[model samples]
Target: MKPELQLSLQFADARHRGALARHRVARFVRAALETSGRIAVRIVDEDEGRTLNREYRGKDYATNVLTFDYEHEPEVVADLVLCAPVVEREAAEQGVTLEAHYAHLLVHGTLHAQGWDHEDDGEAEAMEARETELLAALGFADPYARG
Candidate 1:
């Protein structure tokens, strides 16, 4: 059975959020989940991103994507935080379009919300493989592929 997705998107940084449309974001997220519940995808500036990372993860800098998994089982529920500046920088560094990078991060965060992790080598490999397949299905290249 296909999962039902309930996505709520918030833009704390409006300047960088419009590059990715709401429908595209939802499509990428839905492709990564096995079953659906609800997800909140918030695009934030460096300040809020750094604050959340420091508060929740002990990191002092703004990261590209942060996934907070609230539930996983009969239904998947979570929040995905994407740092706009970080994402833009990374996209430039990786020589990919902003939309492609957003799609990859959305897929990555959704996987995390569904209880997928890359804590170890084996786990990372499996998770990355799944991500690649899903992205390919969505007409995106492998996000981890070297240039």
Candidate 2:
């Protein structure tokens, strides 16, 4: 059996959009790593997303999600900050289901927390392929699958 992991989901919005998706996320992450840890997912707006991405990654744009891997001491404490607007826009433009897209991004972010990066072409290919397989196993469509 996979180890126990705790998750906390926060939303900057007044509604419960992320709350609806939390269980899927928890299932995805836990099954992927098969480890014991604590993770927090925060759904934020553009401003906060931009600020954080800039501060931590030195990127000035508001990306979909930023994963902060605080520690890897078995009990992991990481933060996944997702921008709602960006996610929605990407979902529509890419012609993917919101739930499937969300699953892909969450898996992508979790991989980052586990020391995966796509900084170069070789690394990008490897990570992207891994993400594709993981998403498929999670019952999600391939995010990189073109229509």
Candidate 3:
């Protein structure tokens, strides 16, 4: 189990509510993948999120989360940057708990790092199903369900 999962977290947000458990987020991601490499998650504000997302994805606006899959030869060192404010607002708008939303995003990003693409309907369904199952095991609600 240890050999299959690796994640490193960096909290850079101004607010540390201590309301959400970082480890829950990590475990949520780890439990979904067959990874043997590290995925680093950094909590950032809109400034950093906007810059990084714009630079890499060509989207001028800051997204709720961005996943940068490592393009190396020998190591999988993906980076997942999550905008804290966006997450909070999204949770409220989506009518989900902050922790559940965080879990959904982390797991979503982790799957992206592991080559799970959801550009089409079938792919999206498969990926969402996997996410639902993984989150359920972790005691989180289905992220796509209407409130």
Candidate 4:
């Protein structure tokens, strides 16, 4: 069953605007939803991404994705921030399509919004397995797979 979702897609960085269409972003996010949710997916430039990470996570560099989860009960509510440059670079480095990488990140972020974490070995394994399963269901290859 597909979980109900209300998604808000924003692009602070227009570089990847053509790549991230509203319906496409919604599809990626919805694929990871286990329950009804209100999620905002924001695509930002390196500057904004770096600032957000520095402020929120005390990290000095731009990251691929950041999840600001507010609620995780009957309905999940959260904001997912994706750094365009970082994602693009990582996709190139990993030899994957930009869309594929975005899908993986969205699934990973959505899971975090629902309280999934990888702080430990066991948690990391479980979360990665779940992500791989969900991505596969969406017709994506295992994100953690290495050749």
Per residue, candidate 1 scores C-alpha lDDT tens digits across 61-131 of 99999999988977988999999999999999999999999999999999999888999999999999999
Tens digit per residue, CA lDDT, model 3, 31-123: 766646677888998899899988998988779989898743354568888999899999899989888888899888888887887999999
Candidate 1 has which clashing residue pairs, if any? Answer: none
* Candidate 4 deviant stretches above 4 angstroms: none
Task: Please give the range of 10 consecutive residues that has the lowest summed lDDT in model 3.
Answer: 14-23
The model with the greatest TM-score is 4
Highest lDDT model number: 4
RMSD of every prediction: 0.9, 1.8, 2.1, 0.8
Cα lDDT of model 2 by residue, 1-147, tens digit:
876878998888534384447677788777556457788888888888899999998999999989999877666678888898888889889998777777888888888887789999999999999999988888877788777
Candidate 3 ranges beyond 4 A from true positions: 71-75
- Report the alpha-carbon TM-score of model 3 versus the true structure: 0.89
Candidate 4's TM-score: 0.98
Pairs that clash in candidate 3: none
Q: Write the per-residue lDDT of candidate 4 for residues 1-147, one digit (tens) a residue.
A: 889999998889989999998888999899889899999999999999999999999999999999999999889999999999999999999999999999999999999999999999999999999999989988999989967
| TM-score: the better of candidates 1 and 4 | 4
Ordering by lDDT: 4, 1, 2, 3
Model 2 has an lDDT value of 0.81
| Ordered list by TM-score, greatest first | 4, 1, 2, 3
* Clashes found in each candidate (C-alpha, N, C closer than 3 A): 0, 0, 0, 0
Measured with C-alpha atoms, the lDDT of residue 44 in candidate 4 is 96
